[model samples]
Target: MSTLAAMIAADYGTIGDILRERARETPERLAVVMETGEAVTYAQFDALADRVAAALQRDGIQPGEAVAVCALSSIPYAALFLGALRAGVAVAPIAPSSTPGAIAGMVADCGARLFFLDAGVAEAQKPAPVPARQIALDGSAVGEAFDAWLAPEGATPAPVEIGPKHPFNIIYSSGTTGTPKGIVQSHGMRWKHIFVGDTIGYAHAPVSLLSTPLYSNTTLVCFFPTLAGGGTVVLMKKFDVVRYLELAQTHRVTHTMLVPVQYRRLMEHPDFDRYDLSSTRMKFCTSAPFSAELKGEVLRRWRGGLVEYFGMTEGGGTCILMAHEHPDKLHTVGRPAPGHDIRLIDEDGREVGPGVVGEIVGRSASMMNGYHGRADKTAEATWTSPEGLSFIRTGDVGRFDEDGFLTLMDRKKDMIISGGFNIYPSDLEAVLATHPAVVEAAVVGVPSDAWGETPVAFVAARGQADPEAIRAFVNDKVGKTQRLAEVRFVDALPRSHIGKVLKRELRETWQKSPTT
Candidate 1:
């Protein structure tokens, strides 16, 4: 067996160790390339990681301690993340787009001893005091500069043993109010993902392009696997349609992970067809609901295997829908992955038979440990089965077909009860997507004295689509109970960084101005 293959086949391994091996095997190979033209060799990346680890250790950071980073994707940030892992420390990657208070709360909640950020985040978060000592990822005056903070280049960190159950990262969910819950993923969970990557296509040293922020698990799923497989990583600090196309063509990127909205925007861009993306071997989408129409479009126009992963950052069960493999099952999110037991349960926690709509819950080897420091919240998210197995409650309502394909309805909390019928927002959104002029749409439950609760549509339209006309088109197609009571035109839907339409914000807008 090849040395790399043997290393990957080991019963257990940490990402840091695998990276060190890659550096040993292919020192001269490109490890990372930034959009701004900076690049690093595998050897250089490994050395930098060593220095980072050594520095963390020298500063009295212990194993199992955490560090916080809020910065745009860059080589230094990536190196620091890897370095922390080497020192057996967990990383809390805060979103730079978060409110200053949220950023400060996350740093404190994660119990980080050091916080690293760039100039932009430093300036924006000046109003909120970060609990940890700050270091600047960029050479700005806000904190100690990264270059100066590094342990000398030749320094090696004291060896530390990393176990499977140790926290790999604490990913904070985007909460609308209060502090977001931190989902603690383990090294074991990440190993499972890395193994899956090898089985799929990451073993080929393919050039992977990532446009999403480093703080997102959506980005790391692709990021970690590419590095583990010794592939070159191409990062975009921010996504731009033209720039994305240019990079894809220039880098001949073979792998990528994009959210559904990104796919929609790229496919709709006028210059999309101009780029040559034949080198792409696999494309992944997750974090938000992926429309069947968009999946079909990607399959038709994009080269590579278009796979949509359905799961949560908490990592309960994952559904992989390979659009290219199952054209007939485009509407469904595919069957449960091997070894992943997915079940649909009624509101009362009773298992439902096939073809019955219920809350989706799943159990797998790749589950998260728990929500960091929130045992009560963690318990709320889990449901124990009759067999005494714990399953993560997806909070998503779906039905499993006889063939085992899972078709999502909507979030259980987002279901609208108009007169007594359960109206799924996705059903309305799907109808709106069929309209020739509707670019994108979101549906939310609005207060209605007549129906108790009513469906309202928020739509982003093309050139000159009338909101009333679009509403009429959608309402005509849906059942009476699912019909929209009002339609509001929007320039674009408010979305989280990972492309999930912020339905709560839409609902708030309707509540604030019901007539509009």
Candidate 2:
């Protein structure tokens, strides 16, 4: 085995082992810091995790069992996650924004014997049923306090053999309920992400400021790498543009991960240029459609390497666009990362030639094992090639340019079939975004009498933009078959927790409206 591989196998095979190593190497170094000024040193954090793991083991929670946590970002919350992994248990971090029913469903779906929540979450989800054994991160009447629930200090749980294929965590789909699919990421996948940080300069004692929720994979992508590299991670419970800039400047944060919406807000902030963001070394964006314009603006203004990652949480394949390096290729997500095999296939499962739009299917080292407890659904997501190699089917439709960069067209479900002509909403939305008066735009297909479905646009205007005029401008730019059926002005487009435009919600709202 290679020298690095041998070291990893000996001392840092799992998340728990790595944390233990860091604690022993740099006990005084700060491991995590929250916006509220709370911080944990490596030694203290590791001991706290030991206590938590011991407590879980005392409660008869066996290895490979799942522990669910639904709370705002906090120091204790981070400890709980590490503690579960330390004991060979899987941590399931559910979205705090989910409805009570959805929260309950996710906790149950993970088969968690212990549920952890903050006072606010417990109060908000009082109506939802939880596990018999519950603990509160923030002292609340709903459950036992975190300090009280932990085992004695310095007490450690018995360690179990951790293999590469062992499940590390189960991340439930956002805004999902009624048999929510849990994406099971294995230890090997996470290890790959952690060690690969060396190549990206994450091992240079980088300090990452994570503004997104802990439940999001987007946040974890930076969070785990920062800690694994023996650096500090600053957490933010919620994102506020002013506060974010203040913290980034104060901490001299070198790295961060943000979705596209957050980037837009930061750029549009009136005092965005006032802050000294020179300390930032790398800034990553993902989880939504990042426009070429936005990428250009950040590359011009932001003092860092701006990268855009295009992939799914299921982890089939990832394409990285280094905006600072590939200034001309801003319109496309970069070529597949090393070891990622990507291909385009038509609806009938036939391979499409270069430049032909088709659904993207990919296979990679980081791919998930499968959906938890749903073999049928898992099988549906996998597409077997003529060579019998399996690949994960990304529901996105895109075409590869001659340069090998992938330009996303639209989601398969979002494609509008108007009079038998396929229209990509992104094409119309891109034109709408070019208008000076339009801040942002989203297009969705609506049921029509004459056509099978027609495209309708919802736009957030920058100034006094007439809906009719905006519609006319966009219609003139697009093809006749892809012209907008109607245009509606809104203060903002509806978005999910991760900044993805909620087109499904828009369709439902439009269908129920009198104008439609």
Quantify all predictions' global Cα lDDT against the true fold.
Answer: 0.92, 0.88
lDDT string, candidate 2, 1-516, tens digits:
843335555524777877888888789999999998889999999999999899999999988889999998889999999998888889899988888988888898889988999878887787988855789888777788999999998899897787777888999877521356899988888887787677676877789999999988888888988888889999999999999999999999999999999999999999999999999999999999999999999888989899888998888888988888899999998989888989999989989988999999999889887999989988998999999999999899999999999999998989999999999999999999999999999999998889989999999997677999999999888889999988988889988778999898788878889363
Q: On residues 272-364, what C-alpha lDDT tens digit does candidate 1 reach at each position?
A: 987899999999999888888889889989888988899989988999988888998989998899889999999899999998999999889
User: Which parts of model 1 are misplaced by more than 4 Å?
Assistant: none
Q: Return the clash pairs for model 1, or none.
A: none
Could you tell me how far off, in angstroms, the CA of residue 92 lies in candidate 1 after the best superposition? 0.2
- Any idea what lDDT model 2 has? 0.88
Q: Against the true structure, candidate 1 has what lDDT? A: 0.92
